[model samples]
Target: MQARSVAGEAARNLVTGTTRALWWALAFVVLVGGLAVADARVLVRVWQDADAFRSAGAAVQTLASEREQVVDGTRCQALSGVAGLTGAGALRPGAPVRAASMPSSDLTVWEVTPGVLDLLTTTARPVRTATGTTTGGLWLADDLAAALGASAGDELVIDDGRVRVAGVYTWPDDGRDRVLAYAAVVAVPATGTFERCWAGAWPVDDDAAGLLYSATSPGADDLRLGQLNSTRGSGYDLSGLVDARPTAVAPAAAAAVGLVLGYLAVRTRRLELASALHARVPKPFLTWQHLLEAGCWLAAALSVTAAATGVAALVGSPGPYLGTWATAGMAAGTGAAATLIGTLVGVLTTREKHLFRYFKER
Candidate 1:
């Protein structure tokens, strides 16, 4: 009963004495830590987006640089041989088909096989006819649909054939000025000679190059072959940026806040701690009691920090940034460590003091 009474008295003294300091510490940690976390999250998201944009730009640039070489002449017959050798199966003739009143754009009408839509990235829908067979109609790129003021299920005349717009699609190497439309090979009139052939093959392979060389007509040296090389060495370098500022600032700020709060707490209860020790209180018990007090402050600080982060996420435009688990874990760990350090400092200062001298001076 005596021990219990002593413990209760110590706990009450700790709480009442340090309440103001605890509040100030909690507010400071929450405000600073919340801002740091939010900033880190935003930076990571933006860097990822920027890297993706850069990759897309690189692919477009590679395709544009090589387009002139592969698409030179009006009639390139060797395209069929090139297609067969590169495992693209067969080459189909394609031409630009447009409506009369439509504004001019760089649009190409391609005649493709049945599963060509499956090979390419498209939003095509399968239509089941009366015979129970599924067939694909004309498909337009997103920009092309916008330009024609058309949507899926709308009919548009391409060449002499009226076809339904199946869906909108995007190509990885497609430029802003380029749009593509597709139809079944059987639906379009055969032009006998193909103006261009769309074939898929990695241009860097020696086997592909050898096949392209043999396929070329003896006199048609103008038939050029271009390959898209989007492979890059290294992506974005986030190491330097992440490590430089936040890592140093967060821990330091936490430590500073902890030290100040801890000093204030110790100063307020100096006499109480002295009295308790002089009353035959065990050093370990006193230390544990002070630790419990520090823990309460630490818990409040963490709760406030969490709430602040959540509120920032809810109200901020573009939303609050959430970083990796490691980043968040490190931040929490640092705060805890700083708080513990501050608590130990206070405890040790009390243990080493000369209680009799303190009373004599008083």
Candidate 2:
């Protein structure tokens, strides 16, 4: 019965105070709901763009500045067994050999284990032109493939050996690095011992940089580590492509919008509220009533915001639907909570005795 009375009173206030109700519904809804929609869509778009660049593979590229003995294959195997490591592979740190090829090419042959090649070119594998399924074969860069007049299954004689062109692939076309365009990686056969001069290890944790250097570059006679290098290659610097300030700024703006709008709405009814108080209406009831009215406005706002964002989700880049919707909900809920706080403060602090002065000024 108490709940019914409070809700009825709140609805009555909105009915009688139609102007204030309409003002809050239309004006504040645009202000608050617009912010929520922008925050959600931008967050989702950035996340989708981020997903294209993100990979579990390590970006750190280790190279030997000085001549050193080949790190044993056991080191990589040990790295695979470690906690932070996802996958480990090695590459030929030495210079690629300029091998003889069709039409006489300027490109060179570099050796990479099947695993390391997978780490670098995970997203850019091109289609095979011929029918052959062999892992221990040659992978040509698209430009290099065209230059050599090569396609998958074609024979290319390099200084290392005669290897078939497995396929063509593209490195991440980040618009800066051209090294991959002129390079070809030969995947060492499964049974061949690793004669690695370069190493690639994918680490799952952020603190694994030190572990990578220590594990791959051990200090011992007949064994030495290489210089730690960043393999970003136009990619490492691309992670920060989106501005992240909105993540923190949007919620704070919502709170401010809620607080200011909520307080103004309550103040408009201060004189009537004071008279009701002098008639012995409970402060708690008034506070609850104010909160309920504010909640109604907020619920309406959120509905509009959700609808707008839903349309955006359909048109925007594909991102996780649940997560984007959750982002909208959380932003709207934050504003609603802050509005309720402002309503409560307005209800408690307004005294009936001060109503005359407050009205006189208006």
> TM-score: which candidate is best?
2
Give the C-alpha miss distance for residue 267 in model 1, angstroms. 4.0
**Lowest lDDT 10-mer window, candidate 1?**
58-67
Candidate 1 lDDT by residue in tens digits, 1-362: 35675468557855676445466456546644654466445545544543443333221111111222332222222333354222221124356666644736434666543323432331122332222222456666555566777666677775577877665554344232232333222223322432233333322233443343433224444444333223432233344545654444655565676565666566556666788777877767777677666776677776666655444433432322454433543455566666667666776687436777656665
Candidate 1 has a TM-score of 0.57
- Tens-digit per-residue lDDT, 1-362, candidate 2: 39889999999877788426677867656876777777777767665554444332224334232354344544543454556444455555335555576535445666655555655543444655446543666688787777778888888877666767777876544542344456777666333334443333332234543354443444533443332322423233323433453554666788888887888788887887887888888888888888888888777767776777666555565566776666665666677778778778878888989878877966
> How many pairs of residues collide in each model?
0, 1
Candidate 2 backbone overlaps, count: 1
Candidate 2 global lDDT = 0.61
Q: In candidate 1, which residue pairs get closer than 3 Å at backbone N, Cα or C atoms, i.e. clash?
A: none
